[model samples]
Target chain A: MAETIPLEQVLGTWVAALLTLAIFSFLYRDNPVYKIAEHMFVGVSAGYGVVITWREAVIPDLIQPLLDPAAVDLAGPNYVVLIPGALGMLMFSRFFPRYDWLSRWPIAFVMGYSSGLAIPAAIQMQLLPQLHATLQPVWPAGEVTWWMALSNLLLFVGVLCTLAYFYFSREHKGALGVASRIGIFFLMVAFGAGFGQAVMARVSLLIGRVRFLYDDWWMTLVAPWFGGG
Target chain B: MRLQIPLAITFLIGLFMAVQFFVPHEVFQYSFESLLAWVRIVGAFALVLGIGSLLRTHWDKIRRRRRDWPYSIVTIVSFLAMCVIGIGFGHEPGTVFYWVFENIQVPLDATMFSLLAFFIASAAFRTFRARSTEATLLLVAAVVVMLGRVPSALIVSFGDTAVGHYLHANMPDVSEWIMNFPTVAGKRGIIFGVALGAIATALRVILGIERSHLGGGGGGGQ
Candidate 1:
């Protein structure tokens, strides 16, 4: 007896392969096939976003707590959810000419809350930690290797020079000019490393698509004829 | 009244969010959590507004019979179909919605991003000219990091040879050092500036000085 491949698996592989090829068609030139795939992508993504948001945020956080018996019992029937829900609905006011300004209220609330929440977080998470790390003693009270000490010294100076480069208040001339020049070198290296990492990530994704096309799509189609699974 | 009320709401909400961080009281904690939940609910509603805008744009395009208008039909149909399937049938595993997402959306999304690999390579070829010292450093660093990140066996074919063995041992270490030290320094400097700028802008927003979010000349009057 021979094993059978499921119809759903076969159909899915075909669809995925075709879509992958459709996207890859752009590498040749912009064409209708690619445009169709792109439009489908946009539509599917938007629909998926709505579904996920409704399920994860609105239902569990807002609707269930408001209406569901089990959820109401757990959270004690909170009516505060109405405020944000109303604010959210108010966002649709942008569609109406007379009520367009009403949209600004929710915008203001979100912006204000986010901005306020960010201030202390920025100070605590980014500023203080970075400052402390940069300001560390190059020659600590322990037996430090020459390379370790050199690395620390370079880091401290590099950070200061980079900061100087960004300091547009003072004109870059004399010592400041030299420091900023060095800062540019460090920045370039950092950017290059970042670009390299990004390229590697994209390449990995490309490889994944290629593997899917070959292993899942091609193999599934041809393997049955070739007496392979 | 409209402008003043929104501005007042902004100030009060912003102040409360900021001040609540310092207050460890149970009431403040509870209120903070509730406020966060409200943010999430509001954000979900905002997503609906976005979808509505998308639908309107596509509908207009189709109605006008604009260039590529047929594609708009595809988008609108797919959007509605997915939404119906997802909402009506539920999006859990084994459902048609989940299958569509797994087969259609996932493949489309992955392939779209994977296409960037080719574009980025093309871009690098065009822009990575080593015309100056900084450019040379960038080119060198990029090449070194790219090569170093790959598996040692792949890059160093003659791993049994002395030079190849040395490279295999040290290439990753060198890449690690570059990322750990210079990258950290450069990124930290940038972060410091950004953090300070963000704090200043947030304070401005909280104080009603940054009224650009209000739209239309950012005037106080409606």
Candidate 2:
């Protein structure tokens, strides 16, 4: 019986459903319930992060193994791992103005590593791959039809003009200016498409929430059996 | 000196990471991997900063009893309550924290995400109006894609053929044409222009010629 379905289990799900509906209602208009739900989300997320840091990261990875190295019976302790962990811990000192400078070790480490990572990754992954992929046949000749050829030509033209549109040093005159303007139009279309996709993705998520509220909770509550039960 | 030192460090580390990707050195691989792991750990700390900012913003509003003060009160109360539940008994399966997270957090996030569907429909309606050649092209492609993706698209027809089938069947052909003829040529033109522009920009940045992102202005400095 103890292992069986509990009252809190039953109540929690329904309460959660109500909160879900409340937050979703904000799409129509902002209200206090939505505010409460939003705050709850933030609070829970922060608390979870802290808990995860303590349990998964700080405890086993940093504390337990380091504190009792001989007890674990490893070849030897990896003391080097402690350096960054200590630095990370010192970052909490920033909360207190007196010890704020201690935070710099960790902050500097983070900034150093991130800058190192981004520069190389950005160049190799984004810039290089894109640049390499760009150089291609000036015209479509293979299994391509007339429309396909035309579209490819348009793409080629669009890419050039778009590139031209961004060119700032040279004074755009006559043909250069006309091509640049055409390039701007293509870039705008691309941006618009990307924005549309983003909006669609977000809205689809919202719709799923609404469906759960209406079909799962509301409809279930008003079922014919509920009137007598 | 502070700025110069950090910039130098940045250049060195970035160069190391970049080289490690192509280089087959064991030490480089180990250091780079270790550096990546450290970055992920540091990223976790960023959430703490975010939480602190959220607290400060809400607390200030509450303390001042500013416009929409009641909302702040609700926010603060909810935040505190959820935090208490989460911290006190989150790991325990039957605890309030676990219950709230599974029941409340999961559902809410899911619901919020679902709202995007309605928003997309509204946005699409506004955007799909054809006023120009480009707009018409966009509308037609969008309609085809939408129809092609759905089972019901077969119901909507022109002549004997299902609009979706016709659209999908021709999509590859159309896209290939677009890609090969216009897109390829356009891309080439864009690349040439971009390459020249980038070369110029890089020269400026390296020589301290373009200093806009650096915030001060021109790169002409000591």
Candidate 3:
């Protein structure tokens, strides 16, 4: 079965092993092997990004509109694609120091549009939805379990106390201090849970690499050949 | 002239788009549809600009023959090689481009991120001491969650299957309850504050009060 494997796949697997080991070597110290691997990784990722952007975005959105015959019916020869196409071109003017100021025009436009777009959308999407979900009935208009009531009460009190911690306009010398203290307790619990979850995620990633080393590279390539298995 | 015009543009464009959200009319939407197309193209171009900057930095290092400049050559060569291969041939699965990405890039990235596990473990060991009440509480809560999340298979190996099952059920339930109640409550408070702050910042930028983004090069027309 190993002999029947394609040369490219075997080679790719070997290269992958080398790259993985190189990156993992950073655990010891930042050595030559790690630096080389890191730089290569950075370069390849950027290059891949460019290829993807061109293939997915540029050709399809900007070029195809003008080139495709059906685009006439869809957008009525909307040479509107050229508007951004030109702006995108202007972005490269950063390479030229004299005309670099021209780059700011596109930057301003992008920033302005983004700021405008995000402000309303953030409110509509995140702010309002989260608030609405928080404010829903504990009983939910149906069966009333103690568990449900208790959880709802916890959630409501938690939100209020948490908000009180952040409300800095009032001095925290009295009752506000008490609510804030409760808020700190709630926050610590949240942080602990979140941290635990994150640790698990990172451990899973380490397990994956170790699994690859053991199962994919060594077991497949080395162990069977040596008759160790 | 430059500062005023650009500021006006930011203000008007922001105001127009924000107003567009409220307006159900086709005219505003029609204009928006056009604006969005440009934004996508510009965003893609922004990525190219970033890549150019990265390449230029490495190219300069190589030119100057800085310490470990040989590594800069490796970066440039790898970048160009990948770029050429990707552009010359499509990046479909099983292609050389895809293979390079999956084998070389993916593994490297995953391994780098996985290194954080060791760092986190060491940090935890150092930080989990019970010097104070708050620290003790934090350490205890962290231990509980970690134990609660441990797989039942591991627990079964240590003890009885029945005990493992009991641990699995209660542990996950307790962990989830902590997340659902306290986490949501704390996170929601933070979210409201963050959202308000973001809104205020956005308003400042739109109104041209935040000219810091215009860059020290020419924001003041100096």
Instruction: Return the top candidate by DockQ.
Output: 1
Cα miss at B153, model 3 (Å)? 8.9
Candidate 3 backbone collisions, by pair: none
Q: What's the best-to-worst order under DockQ?
A: 1, 3, 2
DockQ for every model comes to 0.68, 0.27, 0.62
CAPRI class of candidate 2: acceptable
Clashes of each: 0, 50, 0
Model 2 reproduced share of reference interface contacts? 0.32
Fraction of native contacts under 8 Å reproduced by each candidate = 0.75, 0.32, 0.67
Tens digits of lDDT, candidate 1, B50-149: 8988999999999999999999989999999998998888999999899999999999999999999999999999999999999998887787787678
Q: What C-alpha lDDT values do all the predictions have?
A: 0.88, 0.59, 0.82
Highest TM-score against the true fold, candidate: 1
In candidate 1, what are the lDDT values of residues A19-107, reduced to their tens digit?
A: 99999999999999999999999999999998888887888889987888486466467677899999999887877767778888898
Tens-place lDDT digits, model 3, residues A71-180: 43564555878888887887777777766666766777888898898899889987998899889887676788889788998888888888899989998768899998
Candidate number that wins on TM-score, 2 or 3: 3
**Candidate chain B TM-scores, in order:** 0.89, 0.65, 0.84
Candidates in order, TM-scores: namely 0.93, 0.71, 0.90
In candidate 1, the residue pairs with backbone N, CA or C atoms under 3 Å apart (3 or more residues apart, or in different chains) clash, namely none
Better of 1 and 3 by DockQ: 1
Provide the RMSD of all predictions against the true structure, rounded to 1 decimal.
2.5, 6.2, 2.9
